[model samples]
Target: MAVAATKEPNRLILFTDAVVAIAVTLLVLPLVDVVPEVAREHRPATEVITGHQPEIWTFLLSFAVIIRLWLSHHKAFQHVRAYSTPLVLCNSAWLLAIVVLPFPTEMVGVFDNSRFTTGLYIGTVFVATGLQAAMYLIIRIDPEVASEDTPLPGEFVLGAVTAAVLLLLALVVALTVPGVGYWALLLLLLSGPVEWAWRRRHAVAAA
Candidate 1:
């Protein structure tokens, strides 16, 4: 029991990392539809492969995004000194979001420039961010598993929430416009500055 108790955090991180790694691997697999059956019948494989530049770019973009999430997960786990059943459950929910990332990425690759696929991709990010932020908050909420260090997890939590709201606003642009919905993701770039200002405000008020 003591050995298991001491190793809980390690187990969580290991499992989460494995899941994230698999998701990242799958993120690129959809792009490999380089030579479709039709293309094989009509043209050389080389020419058909060259035609998938857009899919390649999409895979690169999605791989970068999911890696960012993985980094965020690592950073959040750094402050976690222990865990409990609730923490495990909450982290499971967050991991579930991460695991689903490759699906929408593949969907976006298959679908035309439609609101449904773009929105689905963006919505996946929003949910993953929200659940991640909630995971950090859960550590703070239940004192039974909290460590001596408070982890100031709100930094990551609020940062993700801020980006999610920005994504929401950007989705409006997506709905109103056409062929430009993905551009809305750029709004997430504001998260760093927003989180900085938020932390500063709290630091000042607490002083």
Candidate 2:
């Protein structure tokens, strides 16, 4: 008799998707309190919208970042056949940071001038990126969990670690240079493309 081959559910991917969706939706919840009178009295609807503009920027940036993070995780995890307890726990830590981003976004919008506020926001992103890096390390150590033919790419691993380190550095820089930190966010947003470019350059050189 042949033994049955069981398929493991990619629970991390599913849970991450659910949490990201909820977090993105929660980002908009802060805007619901701007009543009609508040809009009219504060300024026109447009100005009121614009006044809370940081909220919009933060929400959009955070939402898109979270979505992209999930996409990357999904791609990376596709190689994995099973996850260990530590990997799952590290992922949860990452998700905790993701879920907490909204609080910092709201705080920054409320007190955009506060240095500590910006630090907190950047710190949250740093923590998320760090956990993601940790997860990658665990996956690399246990290639047996990965698909046999889909060995993790060296470029992918390098890129993940580089981006995580850059994010951590950006968090530290944010403490002194808040404006630079915002610009760094734009740079961090381009990590995927940067990683692709790096791999392409290496391939061309090898050829």
Give TM per candidate: 0.83, 0.81
Model 1 lDDT tens row, 106-152: 77777856899888888877787777777778665655555656554
Error of 2 at 66 (Å): 0.9
Who wins the TM-score comparison? Answer: 1
Off by over 4 Å in 1: 1-7, 35-39, 42-49, 176-179, 203-207
Flag clash pairs in model 2.
81-145
| The 10-residue segment with the lowest total lDDT in model 2 | 1-10
Overall lDDT per candidate, in order of appearance: 0.75, 0.74
Scored by Cα lDDT, where does model 2 land? 0.74
